[model samples]
Target: MFKISRRKSVNLSIAVALSFIAVVAVIAVLIPFAWENTPYFSKLVNDVVINESQQLGRCVFFVWLYICFAIVEACCVMVFVLLIRVRKGLVFSEISVDCLRYISWLCMLLSLFLFVGEIFHPLMFVMAMAVVFLGLCLRVTKNVIELATSIKQEHDFTI
Candidate 1:
């Protein structure tokens, strides 16, 4: 049994997510150096589909990677905040809905960016589709949260 107290669990999740963001930030900053020094990756980055049939340059590919990583970090931050709200007993608040909405939009933004990247790289096509699907699911979840918030407000008023 993996039973754990809710507060401890929430704190652990938040810590893990923050750690992930930090690690991703560090990796994103070192991406250029990594691509330059890693022999196999350097070759792949330079000799991939870009120079052949794709119009995107090496700089553009790096830019795409940075943007995607930024979006992921942003999403993780939002999730962290949302979990905090849950811990604070604001589970059905409008703020939570707004946070969810922003996350959904972020997902869509990542999807659009990946779609453009996919036009040239072709490898990003699956990732783009997956992000778009994630955005759609988040939108649905936001709606559900919004409804619950409204119902809770009404119930509170009646009480």
Candidate 2:
């Protein structure tokens, strides 16, 4: 028989959540690739055209969508790596810090992308602000974690 500690159970739960996020991100990326052939996506495109000016070509719109999805996929993969590190009890390690930094940068990139997208669609400006806020939060969290890791190492060496 195998027994799992409370901490292990928590880690497992987190891992499951991260896995779900990764799957969703992947689906998001795949959907755009399949968008041209999917009737639902085609209808959605038609609706957008009906509401907005048809100045944006479909190719350009899809290219931008793919770029955004790629960024999201990269961020999800980084988060999954961070989750693995957490499961191994390496939350304060350098690799974890790097992962956090990468995720933060990805968020920043997304914010910028959305900001540019806002030129064509006003709603994207709101999304850009939200993404920038999230990125700043992650950056702050990464800094705090790095400081804590350094302090812990100093304490260990002193003892």
Clashes of each: 0, 0
Cα TM-score of candidate 2: 0.74
User: Quick one: best TM-score, which candidate?
Assistant: 1
What is the lDDT, from 0 to 100, of the residue 70 in candidate 2?
Answer: 86
For model 1, residues 103-140, the per-residue Cα lDDT tens digits are 99999999999888764456788988999999999999
Candidate 2 lDDT tens digits, 74-142: 887888788877777899888999999999999999999998776447789999999999999999999
Show where candidate 2 strays beyond 4 Å.
1-56
Query: TM-scores across all candidates?
Result: 0.86, 0.74
Report how far off residue 14 is in candidate 1 (Å): 0.3
